[model samples]
Target: MEKTKVFTLVFKTLFFLLIALFFSWGIWNGYFSMIFTESERFLLLLQQHLLLVVTSSLMAVAVAIPLGIFVTRPRFAKSEWFVLNTANLGQTIPVIAILAIVMTYLGIGFNTAVFALFVFSLLPILRNTVAGLNSVDPAMKDAAKGMGLTPMQTLWRIEMPNAMFTIMAGVRTAIVMNIGTAALASLVGGGGLGDLIFAGINLRDNAYLFSGAVPVTLLALTVDGLLRLSERIFIPKGLQEAAKSA
Candidate 1:
């Protein structure tokens, strides 16, 4: 590889290493122990938090992508605004309100919290997907159709590839939001980092609160970074370069 490429790789590696080291130093001094005590289930809470976020984000992607695609069709073109507005309306409600409503009907548990988080995570993705697909060059779409590609083939090969970065942006937003919102799950008997923070609040312990909050923040950052990496990997090289330049 060229010297410039080698230097860039080394720099990126060290940057991440520094972050790992920072966390390691904090852990070494018992900074993390404040949350992880002899009997405390810190790891379990962390696991639950991650599970909720991942599951809810995945569910949102599954629904939002298809829904976004469906609404952009000619048959649904006139109703697109109505459907998107409905999704926008969902976002207007407070997440806690949505959670409570679901809890009331669905009962308190992991599943209910997931449902609420899924609702909260939907708008960004749905809006971005529609916008992304719509933003595709109409001429390119026509060209695709003229080349004997079926509608679905044109969408899959031309539209989605061109729109991938935008779609991934939506996915990234939802994932981060999902992570933060998943903390609320604890309020409804859904175990997660939020339980720790709430427990610390009740007990007036800063350590416990930071323990939960810090990890959640870090988790969000890590996930966001991973998504960016995934986007770079999946995005067309020319588009990636264009994005970087822009």
Candidate 2:
């Protein structure tokens, strides 16, 4: 198991480095510098685009977590399946259509992008939160009750801790998804790195394309790495080992 984990981590690290090197090659090849003379523009674009990703992800987690908790209760379980299925279908809907409709209704810009990204970010967290909470052993709940813990206490002290790993996994997925979807925000004039991409496409400039594409890819990988680090830091080692064995 240790060997497998070491191998996996090495593979992932190498993969990330390879991608970064590829993008760096493009950037070094004068592909990105041809269009943008100001480094600050890239920084500003990163700030704006990353802001959208962070906000949308937070909104999804906020709404999904509570609904997920509510649905896990015995009273809501049966009907909650409907909500879950709805979310599943929401995932299946084309993100482009969702973005387009949102842009039309909201009249363009960041807000439309937020709405679209938020919707796109919902499913993984919602479904995983449900699944994670449900996967907690019932015996743990029973034990908590026998020990005189209230429902809230049982959830806070027992269920949530056990489910943390899965919830984090969902969050990681949402973050990566949000990062990718954010590029589409440029379509409706959200002024993201996508601005570089669309401008490139419009003028037939590879430099503009590389400018947009490289940054977005780096942003996704960076967030993914951070989330993976969070998982390692937060998840209990014993639980991780057991999970690996399972």
Candidate 3:
């Protein structure tokens, strides 16, 4: 515990120092000269990026969860293999290829970008949901059922609560993946922080690139940390107490 706490403290200190260095560099380069104006644009770009990630990821979760549950159950024996193979195939398809296919059929811009992202984002969430749900203790499930709980109630009240950490872990992975992949949205004329990155690349300007890369990386880390924090919080109180006793 002491070691873990020390590590967490070190990480926090390093993260703050990175932020300080990023701002100081920006200021020295006149990048932060018009602080308010640059800040607004930076935030707007982040908003767009966040929108794309959240929307597409949630859409994926919506589709993935029900299908994950359905396929994992014994009654859907035949469909299980099909769902697994399809998600496997989805993961193998390159983002660029998916974007091209989407653009051809769905036209360009945000809608097409979302569709491509949805496809890219589905596999992890689907696979994790199935894995977490499957890993639930059979004894606990039987106890829930014996208590006269409906299947839905058992899922929501028992299985899901227990699987919270695992599910959040999958969500953290999906979010990080989406943040990186969302940059491809630029290919379809979908404006995002990717514009900053590509603009920098075209201009051979490192500052322009760092302007985007820094924020995106920070966002991913922040979100991932928060999810992990939430996983800690959502762990059953009894479990924490037991751990403390041990």
lDDT minimum window of 10 residues, candidate 1: 31-40
| C-alpha-based local distance difference test score of model 1 | 0.89
* RMSD from true fold, candidate 1: 4.8
Q: Write the per-residue lDDT of candidate 2 for residues 1-246, one digit (tens) a residue.
A: 999999999999999999789868887888878436867887888888988898889999999888888899887889688989998988998888888888778988888888888999899998888999999999989999999999999888888878888888998998897898888889887768888888889998888888888789878999899888888777778788888999
Query: How many backbone overlaps does candidate 2 show?
Result: 0
For model 2, the stretches where C-alpha displacement exceeds 4 angstroms are 1-28, 34-36, 236-246
- List candidate 3 segments past 4 Å from native: 1-40, 232-235, 239-246
TM-score of 1: 0.86
- C-alpha TM-scores of all predictions: 0.86, 0.87, 0.82
lDDT of 3: 0.81
lDDT (10s digit) by residue, model 3, range 42-131: 777778888888899889879987787787666776897789889989999999999999899989899998989999988888888788
Q: What overall lDDT goes with each candidate model?
A: 0.89, 0.87, 0.81
Q: Where is model 3 poorest over a 10-residue stretch in terms of lDDT?
A: 30-39
In model 2, the worst 10-residue window by lDDT is 34-43
Candidate with more favorable, higher lDDT: 2 or 3: 2
**Which residue pairs collide in model 1, if any?**
none
Score residue 188 of candidate 3 by CA lDDT: 88
lDDT of 2: 0.87
Better of 1 and 3 by TM-score: 1
